[model samples]
Target: MSVSELEPGDREFERTPPHDIPAEQGVLGGMLLSQDAIAEVIEVLRTADFYRPAHQIIYDAVLDLYGRGDPADAVTIAGELTKRGEIARVGGAPYLHTLISSVPTAANAGYYARIVRERSVLRKLVETGTRIVQMGYNADGADADEILDRAQAEVFAIAEKRSGEDYVPLSEIMPGALDEIEAIGSRGGQMVGVPTGFADLDALTNGLHPGQMIVVAARPAMGKALGLSTLVPTPEGWTTMGALEVGDEVLDADGRPTRVVAATEVMHGRPCHEVEFSDGEIVVADALHQWRTSVAGVTAVRTTEEIAATLDEVHVIDGPDGRVTKIVDVRPVASVPVRCIQVDNTDHLYLVGRSRVPTHNSTLALDFARAASIRHGLTSAFFSLEMGRNEITMRLLSAEARVALHAMRSGTMQDEDWTRLARRMSEVAEAPLFIDDSPNMSMMEIRAKARRLKQQHDLRLVVIDYLQLMTSGKRVESRQVEVSEFSRSLKLLAKELQVPVIALSQLNRGPEQRTDKKPMVSDLRESGSIEQDADMVILLHREDAYEKESPRAGEADLIVAKHRNGPTATVTVAFQGHYSRFVDMAQ
Candidate 1:
């Protein structure tokens, strides 16, 4: 029969039964009058709500017998009940068989639980329907209100049972009664320091806490990827991870160049007597004999793409003479040329800065000014004035002015204007502000690389060149939803990593539509959640770039769109195109 056609009593009987009264007591006090008395007992047993205490006990007993591989037939059950003084005699065998046949088999433990859990609600609804029928309500005009009331009452009872104790006050408990400090101290102390460039940011964030995910997002051509690259660290005198040139020589274990050999040339039987893999695999090749041997299997792949595609597999390829060879697996073979440094070590300081401007101008000046302002502001705001007020002075010059300054006499006041600015900034700030110009990167790849760096070196801070060029790995009905999820993930990563992730984002097309072209928080493209998620959001606008200017062609306004902990204000900074930098205005 269909589930809906089954009577409530039949469904409930499959799950659980009601009380276990003695058979002697059943015959006393006119309880056992006729066949109707037996029918009444059967009906009560079948329709008992399993969620009630009495019903739950009987259900548990039935389930326990089933678990023990006992048949749940009425004769077996009646005998058990008689032994417990619950029944005086076994019921008619034919009637018992009918009940047993109707009982649903508990195919799985979860299925049995669901049946028992649903019995109470189903029985109550059936009773409400019966009552409405007796009250002269036509089947077609039955009031749903009574059924709903009964169902809600059962639900409320179940909810009440599940919702146990109220919350306890912390003040009432003894201090550290649970010994939380000792428990935490028992585990290895937390690792610290994935650095983002800001000191206050670092102080609040604790320098890129381990096991944390971070996103460096930026607009198209805003150096988001370049900013992430700067986080990777290399040994002193070695170029950082993302520098343009691959050094002429690969350093050996002893930090000396063994030789310069291309992978293709080596594979084509060009002699390499001493070829060492970064992971300690050795290759010995005799170019003259066109033969090669290695303790570890040596294989050669034609391209990096081939290697990447088979990265997860056991890659073996045919060598020049059709000899089976094992390929040396580079731990990190860059899919694209490393435009950003990957800092693996947490001990040394590293900075990640991203920009929203596609060109170098937006990132350079904002980064320089930000670094300078933070450094000088910390010194001036925190320490004594008498200790010699240290300030990071910067001059933003256009391409034409830079050319004119270069033409001036060496060491002259005019020549030193830009030089002095650079020098003063260097003196005030602990590290030089570097610029990144690379574009779009997938969020998964970005998180993977950031996590790797944090594991290797304990990264302190991560800055994105910008947020717009970031690819959210989501295919949604709306681009707005995709961007919203992406923004939320970035904030969650920052909080989870306990580091300040400063991402540069683009203003919406609405700004371009306006006459002034000034940006506000509303200009945050796609999602309003971006504004909500960010600890701070800054909008970079240069009025002179859009409108005609007289003298200060290099000035730009920085609007602090949203700041969680500080006042929102607009600051004017000088933007230089030539040096690819920004400077704080002399106040």
Candidate 2:
């Protein structure tokens, strides 16, 4: 009978789990022979990953020495073991010499480490299976669903352990953290993480850092949508959605020309709608298409569907001269092919149709993701809980190529835009920026995916667009509790991954109630834990967003309300709404 058919007490089932003693010896020997080998092997095989007890002790000693910037050869490793009174337990110094002699060459240390790690994983699988079998036997009256979930958790635990979630001594972390701080200081206070592309903000917060949860909160209508087939204004002239290409230049919400950095392929069979304005202008778009509107003096970006819900409310259209227009009617239209594009403007808006009506683009997370990958050459992962992957990609492209998002969404492009995209395409394409637009994900799922990305890509950054959309996976008493749980879990995730996590958040109506209309740390919706969990909190404020003709029309305030490691200050940044990005005010 095959192994699966064998009983629990069968001889085959009692056999030793998978392991390779020779491979473990080879790895230990290589590490002893060359200090460089230690660096390579350590990443693949942790101390517990070794099959033999002696090897585990040896591995730990070697790592301790290495972390302290000391030698890890036979003599040093033996001395380290001796200090812990474990020298004899690890077969003494002579065993170390024997290991060095056993290895032919240290050059294949990584290969040897892989062999050891593989066997360890197989051994873990066996252990996990045994535990699951026991659970099944003992789960007599327990809920079947609970037992199943417990079994699944047991299986997934292997992956979690392999992801380096084991507790580490403070000794191992302080060196790296201090070294990083010193390096930043050496650079005369240069940013230590992904650059925000805004100098003052970079100086204030030291960039969007790793293992951090950055909250960019604002009132509604701050950003995003567009469908295909909408006419868009361009420097070369107006163009149909189907005619637009990457690198095409188009006018932004400010009526300034910007390039299309990214454009999506035609999406067919989308539910379409026709929105009519008071000026007798009609634009055909999908329900997801966004429009800049003002209701009772509160200007915000609203989707076609949202606008349709309140037909009686006066909707003010986007205009440079502060002209207000009302929505006459919104009716469903025939399904049609739709396209989307993103530009490099900070305001992330562009004009559509002859009426010069303005529409929106998305967030700052894509900009940080793009900067981390293309500018800093670091791998980054963006978890877009709201937008789709295509839209996220287009936004990144827009930020990188200095193109306008609305222009690209409407498929309005000019030759200059294409040329600009061409210049940046190679960098953008090669960037280690991974986008996952999976919607309504739980924090547990995000952790699992982020762990995998961390292992495979050496992921350095994570950006989650808005936190409230995330679920706690299990049922909670209230939304606030769920959000609070997510907030705490996100902090743990950042620490576990050792990378910064930028989680976009929505502020409560507290900002709208204030005359200044500035958000505070207390405004983080649904949870007080969000304020406690975040290493930094950035409240995004634009005077022009509240006051139509303010003197600071194009300026944004990045209020660093809470900086765990540094001083909190408000950094003024230029809101290049047209280019879909933020720049230093001097720019």
Candidate 3:
């Protein structure tokens, strides 16, 4: 019978249950057409959410197909249903074929699923109402209030019983896991995890490990500390120790209004200050130092030089368990001899240095030596510690045209050289290259400046000419520890900026003493930790430096002595001293 033809008395028996058959069909059709649609509708509706019993069977079959990581097209779904002897019950192959063809686009599967869910909720409401009415009829001597409460709870339970989520078969789950493994492989696996800005921490705990709690705990305590006081945020306002009177109303952490039955101030002198809540929870006021010291001009109060000593110098306060900072003091000392590397003279800041060969580096035309890093289609920043930006640009022009560096230096360029340089000028001018000749550059300065460059130019690579030339600008107990910290910081900067930092290292006297005169990972100057922190380490070795009579005098060996993810090997590239650059053999 039609639903509209039903009278009030005959409605229960004559009227159809609340449902939209087309919506159920659309949701099923959407899932069958698009493999991605299954995830959208899986949590929103269930087998029972369908109005037609046959459609429920089809939905279950589609879920089974998806769970097994199999396609949910008509053929595969029908095959699974037929294997279970349920295809006949679900209207056979023709019905399965008709399902996917019903939808032109599966993108609206979520909308269709919600419509089906709404209909299901209405049907559940009607079923609940029918049961409540029957309960009223049978309410002979039962408490009317009890019956009403039970009926209300049962109706609410239907709403609470949403379709289950967070369930997936192993077949569907394994593919994403494999994809992540491949991604980790791409990131060299050693640095696959998030960085903690500390190499020691990264080595010990893998840097704020995922799917784990990061608890800061101290080891071997030197002294004890009083407990801390905390500020509890509540609905009426922030909860206070004195405000927890018997009649006072305050909110809980969940923002629910809670009446104060009892609150006690405890451990007043026991090295800890805390207010014990009725809920047995404690709030911490450890942030008071951060709010007061680091932040400036928050409360519209004028702070004197004594209060706002931030201009003096920045301090990096460190602790075993945790740390807080205080930026106070402002004073400048005498200037020292500072040097910058040579590259483009753009106003951007850079961390530049010079890599001088042991004895023969001088008079070898050192200009444009840093520009070789830009060959691989990289937007490079060269921090020149010694060379001027003008000299570097001239060398780059010479190198691009394959002309003699001396010719360009002496303004003795020929007509052909000028023609070649004009063509290369357009290439050089538009390239994402930057040079900074700032002398006495510090690690802090490099980090701040590099972030600005990356934001402005989307910088891809940073070349620090040599690691030994860098200084933290702070005195330490030993130089080794300081260099190691700088190395770790450089590694951290690489990860933060999401770019490869190609830092040249000036090997110690060890390489010169050896008969082979080849640099190794141990030759990285002054810091053993550089080897530990670097994902890849390449050492420059020239046989001709020791033996000029060698057959490959111009050939340089780039020894990949350390590779964290793969085997190390050597690559041969020709270094033309005339052009002051390395040229790939293929080029």
Candidate 4:
């Protein structure tokens, strides 16, 4: 009967309708079990029941159709489901399609995809015995909040399971993916290698690799810049991009100032004279003669502005100092473009050296100094003896045998002691060593340098001469902030560069307190980042230098205050006053 035809209270109060009897049992009762009945059924079948042959066959068929880019229709799905024996009732095929189709498309698709993607999640949710409210017109009177709470709990359980501990090594997951292919290497034919400038230094470090930020640091007269100057090519072979400005006087490699003279004037006797024409062209005869001479081409125009509209390849003038006489049409030169390689002139070297400055900030300098001090302390204490011997061998007497002979003749040390030191020094000078002297290098520049070096030349060792001298910028207000920034920058740079950045640092007046006089990490000037960032720290202490004509003579103690990678120890090295170098201790 229609709702309008029936009187409001005419029906017997509290009496159940005839159809409600069957509806309360079996399928009707199940339909009333949940608001999202279809989704609940799908989730149940997808996880818990999927392991059953029937459920597996049905899910595989449906996923296969989806993967094959075919539309899933009720009839096809019913056939697939029936083939898998998931339906037993005679009319189950049509009944299942009706049930599936009756579900909201958005809700059904989302639920199905989630169940498929995260099976374990759905399994955990179902195991929780979650309650759900029915969402059909027939079962409109259901507890929505209870249903929502149960569903949320189930999903949360599943999420937890999915995020549980699991580990996978990169090697097993992806094989041969990262293997290097040399044919596709950068810079064409440039082979990656190490720099073998010293022996003991190389022993501790393999060698200087390309693209590393090596810091070579020292106090005012420690030969920091001189050491850097010795690395880059001098005299010729290097090209520069910008203008080279030497101090007021320009000097060649021999320290002689060069005088500029016109090439034509040198080649020819007289200065080149010129005559201008009405058509905006000039003709010239050799006046001040030069090495090269040619009046190639010119352009003619009525207005002055048109004169600039000429090709760069074509020569527009008669000669140097020669006047334009006639407007002549000429084809541009077809010479091949020569790739200009920058020559490392004094100015160019300065610019390259300057580009390594780190940012002007507090955290970086402190970190850089701390790292440098630690590195210096460790290397100096343990490897200084070897470094000294290696330096002498490479730079002076070509062999170990000659070191003892020279030591005897020079009266620097006893023959036996010198021989023993030389042997020990030679053994230690085999590792790689790299030094970067850039003022304040940025992280990007440091990383780029490291990566490029590794990729292009496979270099691993690096060094940076004295840390404090490295400038971040002129804007830094306090020396503490500047040093802190420098320190952090160096640490990050060392880690990124994947090489040891041995930075030299200055000691504060604290060293003056003790008579023994060896600087400590606390003695690092200005910033504590040096202590925080360095893997090692070494202090060069000379007791004789403090006293005038002291009996200790040429002995210097390389003190190891911090060693992040190894044991801390002190070593004695012979300090040569004449050459400003060090030598290993006699055994």
- TM-scores, each model vs. reference: 0.34, 0.66, 0.43, 0.32
Candidates 1 and 2 compared: the better one by TM-score is: 2
lDDT of 4 at 53: 37
Locate the minimum summed-lDDT window of 10 residues in model 1.
Answer: 379-388
Cα RMSD (Å) between model 2 and the true structure? 11.9
lDDT of 4 by residue, 1-587 (tens): 76556676754323332221111112211222233433344434332323233334444445444445554445665676677665553245555444444444433443443444454444444444323223223346544443443354344335433322246557433433333334326536332324222233333433333223333221111001111112211122222222232222222322123322211111223222222221212223232112121224223322211222332322233311122112232112112111111223332212111111211111112222222223222121111101222332332222223343223333455666566657645443532223333323543344445444544443444444345545544456776787677777667655543555555565554665666555676877667777777765656666654443346666666565665544666656665432223555565
lDDT tens readout by residue for model 3, 1-587:
67777787887666788788777778988998898899999979877788899998999888877877888888888889889999899888998767777777899889999998998888887877888989999999876655765575555446555432336779757867998889868767475443423233334333322222111100010111112212222333333343345555543211234554443333232211121111111112111112222233233222223333444422322222222222222222122221111112121111111221111222112222233233334455776554457866776777677786656654667998888888888777766678776866777667666766766766666656445556655557776897787788778777656666655555554565567767677766667888888876656666754443457767767565765645667767676655655655444
- For model 2, residues 384-464, the per-residue Cα lDDT tens digits are 665667766776677778886555665666889889989998988998988887755767678778877877788899887
Alpha-carbon runs more than 4 Å astray in model 2 = 1-13, 23-45, 58-114, 128-165, 171-190, 222-361, 389-398, 403-406, 409-430, 471-475
lDDT of 4 at 66: 49
lDDT of 2 at 471: 61
Report the CA-based lDDT of candidate 1 relative to the real structure.
Answer: 0.39
Superposition error at 419 for model 4 (Å)? 22
Worst 10 residues of 4 by lDDT: 219-228
- What is the C-alpha local distance difference test score of each model? 0.39, 0.73, 0.55, 0.38
- Pick by TM-score: 1 or 4, better one: 1
